[model samples]
Target: MGLESNSMPKIVIGDFGYTLEDVPHLSDFIPDLPTYPNPLQDNPAYSAVRQYFVDYDDTIAQNIVVHKDTPRGIHFRRAGPRQRVYFESDDVHACIVTCGGLCPGLNTVIREIVCSLNYMYGVKSVLGIHGGYKGFYSKNTISLTPKSVNDIHKRGGTILGTSRGGYETKKIVDSIQDRGINQVYIIGGDGTQKGAAVIFEEIKKRGLKVAVVGIPKTIDNDIPVIDKSFGFDTAVEEAERAINAAHVEATSFENGIGLVKLMGRYSGFIAMYATIASRDVDCCLIPESPFYLEGRGGLFEYIEKRLKEFGHMVIVIAEGAGQEMLSESLNQKDASGNKLLQDVGLWISQKIKDHFSKERKMTINLKYIDPTYMIRAIPSSASDNVYCTLLAQSAVHGAMAGYTGFTVGPVNGRYAYIPFHRINERQNKVVITDRMWARLLSSTSQPSFLSTKDVVEDSMDDKKETPNYALLENGFADAHK
Candidate 1:
């Protein structure tokens, strides 16, 4: 239940073209480290409360075996208590920077990091790096103190601001050296973490003792091995409002269809969960499930059948879903090198309209709602605030403990330090075969497959039979045909 027996820190060789020789061993520079001072060691109040700290079990147990090398799986130890830190209080100078797109808990994480470094470790020289990685070389920094970041967590967004796509290695290291900053916390997503790994490798190559710790920040919740990233719960909560609005709009009019697009560049957690939470969604589409447009049991046919059964339908689709259906090129990328996904919501809406107009000479009123910016700009929810605070505290603990080239996140249901190499190995996507997907299917009542031989054979059997227009007098046949 504790990582103490197998608490060997592993050196991770990053995927940023760094070889094994480039990484430094922990024993090389940090041998015989001193334990953190116990301020409560001599206090009379400590004797009564000492059992709380001594018997604490913050190590998380894995549900299944993650790797063959470790049969019991990986266990993440809590980063405080009697653990020794590599940096001295007055000698330590730390920097915090936020990068990538906006998430709900960025400001909360920043505030917690500043507070932890100042109060817990008594680190005085904490600096807020502005404009992300460029802030290092650009000399845009604000001196951080306990008073400066006191009320920042009350608001949303980062106090230091954020940017993307500034991974200049030499200039960043030179600035670190010139400014005498020994510890750095980079908060962002996958691309930002990759840049952090490169920066750490550069620091090690220069033989500097600077520690780089990453705090994973992605609203998409796509980081590998992390149980849930900060801002995801808030995003899902905010997205529910949009889904509810769409449902109201769809059901208000005749033959109404409300199509909503949420953020999920490579994965579909937001769309999947929002559909489950909203409960009014007729169909849910995501990047994990490939959907077709005009087959026997395709999306269009499903919508047509739903309209016939209930006069209206609500669809929730992730941003990255149905990208293959787009005929245009997606060569453009954002500042973080992420591919710009095509507008699938608009495309689907237009396609549905055209299909109804051209094939059946019928009109379908469809409304498209894109609430991506609104969801990402909101403040953190109550759950995300707690999650972000814990992440920040753990990150500061890792940096103080001389752990570098790693990200601090909740892994296997516990807050743990995850190496960057493992993060970049693969993307975390929703498994369509999982219980979550099964729940989604049950909630939406959508068919699992877009096309099937049985569906085609049944259509062929229907075509072979004589036409039955007895219900045409009731106006149902005219409305559909």
Candidate 2:
């Protein structure tokens, strides 16, 4: 929501029975900031729309589920083109930077951001910051236009390039101020968003008129406060190919086992979803559920029994799954300070082979397939392409409206402006007790592989970590109006 009828800005509540956490605005620091009519009103491209401007009090609910006793829940400022913007089209200068690992739809987001700025707002001076945050000082800036990014959506990876952990807020903010970039679009995961938040703080400390907008990007679908990240759909779609290949290999030989490793550093959505989608998978392992190798209710016993009955089976494991069973030396950290995970695929594969050959005195054929980089290096699926477009446009809209220190994403099917701290506070992990995980268990017929104590502990932990939008009454009408 953008325009204010009165000169005074609306009050933003930090937290009450309901949460109205709004993003920072230029008006928050600078008094009597000039407002310009949104260029979209005069653009022929938007002339066909009947109603375009978002209401000042419009918001998107974070949680749609409610009970009779539910208190007012969390809501976020809705994202869209506003009638009045804080920045004029002629004065606006924008730059975009991508960080962290490669993912599908990265290029699509870049292409759309450039295109939307030029076509919709008639703001043509868009710069692409090469590499990650270090790109501000170390790398060259390339001018981006609709013409330059026309066919980039068909490609994989980010055109701006990316790296891990080069966040120097002072240096980055200095670069922005020196270059006259009023709008900063950051595309990356939680770590990158954290850096974006710091950059916003530094920008504000200097009393500069800049808007920093983050578009959450992760193939893992692990970012919180959003329904799902952009490339997740494409990652799930591509995983089906690997699962099919594994099934083919496993079914070809007697006593065969197909081991497929998927990318999920902390979450298991990819492995879980792929197992459910492929139906041929006999077992799925993820970081959320612990599994043992020996004794009753162990993975070895289940695998042995399954092979004896069916002659062949497929096992899908997330990269982060079974980390507790790995060597302690593998528990290192990367440049981004994320724990370096050991290869669970190879370890489990060898263990299965050893158990069958040495313990059971039998020979078994096993094949392992790692499609981690393969999935990340491919272009996004059709659905993800459309999603990237929407996310890019939303970031542009928020920046133009002078909303700073915010990230744009679809929460409960509606796009909203969420503050950065909410996302980086914690990861969006897969709840083992959720019905979706139960569906995966049903599909694969895999044992929960969890002890009574583990289950109880997890349940208690979930209860302790209540969601931001919890127990809300029907205050949507009263809250907004």
Candidate 3:
């Protein structure tokens, strides 16, 4: 067997399908492989020999290589070696900007980026853009160094500051060109990624060679394909604290109910995870799962039954939940153009109060809590700090490798480059049929059929209505059956 210093070990075939003679030599394919500088040479964390190029034929089991279209578009392969970098460390100028609302790991990401670029790549000219996209044109920049961002990850929020609704593509591109920044890192959510795409297109239109990279920053964990977004773990952890407080307040009084509103405009991951973590929540309301207010088998009826049995109940709700139930027109939008959802927590509290006072002639104690901003402004958890570091490192690696017009995130359980168009293609919503939802339903023991279709079917049933007391005494399963 031929032994190469920086290549895969040669294996001898005995009774296997293929023999050593049948395999092609690596030298035949990569005769003149370029030698790239190894920054992490002293560190044992990274492998010395990196797989720079991957062959699709090598993944096939057959002896003959077939070049046919696969079902999933492409075969899986590891990233090749890092040889082509767009910027030279000594002369390159880079800018980092944050946009959208606050997330737990925003500062952590910024710190990691600056540290990696300064230490790993020896980049000297690092500038921080303040106030999101508007800062790009307004020329609000702060000089960054390894020392300046060393302790930023220990704090919450972003040192560069952040905002939304400033998407001047032309002016931003002009500013980038004027500053001679070859690489730009943008950290934000869906709207911010959209803005990055526009800025990238303008740069390309002007025939400029600027690499624009995005770090997917959303506490909602609504970005698709990726397993989870940074700061999401911290948000869920903090939201659990609010849920705990709500539980304490609810259980203190007779027939009391605690309602908590969490951040998740188009998704429900935060509410779902927080409810699961708290384990004391009796009901969970999310944007994906709609619930009814007044009916034979509705939320009000369920609450009445639970209160009768358990005396008190704790409920967690996403901000976007039950907006359709509200009669008021939703004409307002925030700086990022996201529709301002109705206050579902307050609405549910009021509805419960009105139903008990007028319909049942009973008094109900409900505590309304909105912990959206509180959760967003806090520092990141230990889990998120590690996640934010990996995300930032992967982003810098991709940006250095001459990859442009893409975002860096974990795809298929590995860190890889994802195009901006694919990142913003659609919103990632909670799958109602998935195991997560099933676990939530099993834990809370809430009515499974809060959906509109289920409510309509129940209303259309000609069977006699079961008594609320009987349903409470038995279980929801017996009542449904």
Q: How do all models score by TM-score?
A: 0.85, 0.91, 0.83
lDDT of 3 by residue, 1-481 (tens): 1111121223335332433212112122324423245344433445554653332223212122334542222211122225445456776699999999999989889988898887777788999999898998888999998898888888889999998884677778889999999889999998888888777666655656667888898989888656689999999999999999999999999888888999988789999999998999999988777667777668888888899999999988888877888889588998788998777778778888999999988778889988888888988999999988888887777666555666766655566556576567677878765678889989999976444454566567854665222112111211100
Model 2 stretches with alpha carbons more than 4 Å out: 1-17, 452-481
| Candidate achieving the largest lDDT | 2
lDDT of 2 at 257: 89
Give per-model CA RMSD.
9.2, 7.6, 10.3
Pick out the ten consecutive residues of candidate 1 with the lowest summed lDDT. Answer: 472-481
- Higher-lDDT candidate among 1 and 2? 2
Q: Which run of 10 residues does model 3 get worst, by summed lDDT?
A: 472-481
Tell me the number of clashing residue pairs for each predicted model. Answer: 0, 4, 2
Q: Tell me how many residue pairs clash in candidate 2.
A: 4
* Alpha-carbon lDDT, every model: 0.77, 0.84, 0.74
Clash count, candidate 1 = 0
Q: Pick the candidate with the highest TM-score.
A: 2
